[model samples]
Target: MQEFFMDYGLWLLVGLLVIIALVFLLSGRRKAEQPIEPAVSAEAAPPPAPVPFVDPIIAAPVAAASVVAEPVVVEPVAPAEPVVEPVVEAPEPAPAAPAPAPVEPAPAPVAVVPAVAVVADGEDDLLRLKGVGPKLKALLIDLGITRYAQIAAWNDADIATIDAKLGSFKGRPVRDQWVDQAKYLAAGDIAGFEAKYGKV
Candidate 1:
């Protein structure tokens, strides 16, 4: 530090004195450059610029960003919850009037037995009839219905008896018209049987 001051101290002091003198001269010239107010006019005219220190570029967005703003945080509020109602079961209907005393029901009538000739006690080819396969023929044989006359004599009672024993083939006797088919077959009416049932 002592060496720096010794080398440049005098030169620095001379430069400072020159700068101060130049500033003094410039200030005096600036004061002289202003026009003298006329004594004739009572009012003073306004200068073109009132504030020379403030620059037009100072109004830019870069100058406005000098101060940092702190953001305000807010907690969200929740909406009110909806209310739920309880469920109830419906009641049974009310009864009022009494029903009429039930009548003594008569016995159901049985189907009339056809007057077919009682055939000899020999097993006929039950399979020759429509819908009577070997399994049914065996079932019929087991039910003591080996002859065509046996099937031809079937009234409601006989049909009910056989239907009770037929298992899966129960309703077949009535639905297939086995009694009617057997009547034609028992009468030895080939033309009638073939015409009624398809080519028995």
Candidate 2:
């Protein structure tokens, strides 16, 4: 009995130590799982009455500016008198002279002449005539003489008139013997024309 009590007492002591350790660990777990209540202050002072937030940038209140008014006295002004200027009389202008009568232009002197008869056949190629070029042909056509017969039959007065009318070609008729060449051409005398002048 004594030996059994000694050996089993040591085992009971170790078992009791294990049970106490388990009880302490479970109690700590339970305490950690439970929700905790907030602690209350003794005199909360109503949260310090929520101190109004003031901006550091705002300036402190100052006394309002004072405005002083003074009385204004206006004096009455006197009325000014009007000044009169002397009037000058201008002399009347003399009557204007009557406009002179307009002078009439003199009547132009006109000469009567026979009208040029237009031939039924068109103008001939006077360029084929000796000393006759495009320019001379145009001048002859303007002078109403486009045919060889017209130039061949020109009288002294007609020649004089044509010679007078010729501006830059004044001496061409007499110098080039246009009448003789024209007469040969009018007669269709190619041989005579070639003999008198160069090749037709």
Candidate 3:
């Protein structure tokens, strides 16, 4: 009976140890499954107090230096005064004497001649002569030659003087045989004029 008691007691001790281990595992598992609570922070600490602002007083010289940093404008200078020369007085001129009275010129001598002389019984048509047109007739009348006889009597000197005065009609006298035509016409010989110089 003593030997049987010892063997059974060992088996009983092992069974008790297994039951205690199961009890410890079950307690740890229950603790892990529970939710954890967060810790609260101490008071929220108030924000640090703001620092007081202060203005600095600057010196007048330092302020003036800042203003002087701007550009400066310079005005143009005025020109110098011009030099003046001394004025001199001119000498006075002598007084002029009274001018002498102008001398009167003597009257020119006047020759007495008749206004009209008997050169022809009456004026004839000088234009009847060859080369004598209305313009030539006017030029001849201006020279006091309204008669055919005057043209017939024209010498070389008279022809030259009259031709020079004729201007555009200068060579007409000699060119058309005006003197020959005048001679026949002055004598009232139309036949002679036509015979020597074709039809008048």
Candidate 1 residue pairs that clash = none
Kindly list the per-residue Cα lDDT of model 1 for residues 1-200, writing each as its tens digit.
99899779988999999999999999999999999976755576764776557665966667678768889898888977878666676776677678988998887655333333446654678898888889999977766677787788777887886787788887998889999998998899989999989886
Return the clash pairs for model 3, or none.
none
How does residue 59 of candidate 3 score in lDDT?
59
Clash count per candidate:
0, 0, 0
- The C-alpha lDDT values of all candidates are 0.80, 0.78, 0.78
Instruction: Output the TM-score of candidate 2.
Output: 0.41
Instruction: Score candidate 1 by lDDT.
Output: 0.80
The TM-score of predicted model 3 comes to 0.40
**Poorest lDDT segment (10 consecutive residues) of candidate 2:** 59-68
Off by over 4 Å in 2: 1-119
Error of 2 at 113 (Å): 8.8
List the candidates' TM-scores in order. Answer: 0.41, 0.41, 0.40
Stretches of candidate 3 off by over 4 Å are 1-121
Q: Please give the range of 10 consecutive residues that has the lowest summed lDDT in model 1.
A: 109-118
> Which should have the higher TM-score, number 1 or number 3?
1
Q: lDDT tens string, model 3, 7-126?
A: 987888999999999999999999999988656578867668998764345456677677756577999999988988778878788878879889889764333211333565678887
Error of model 2, residue 61, in angstroms: 99
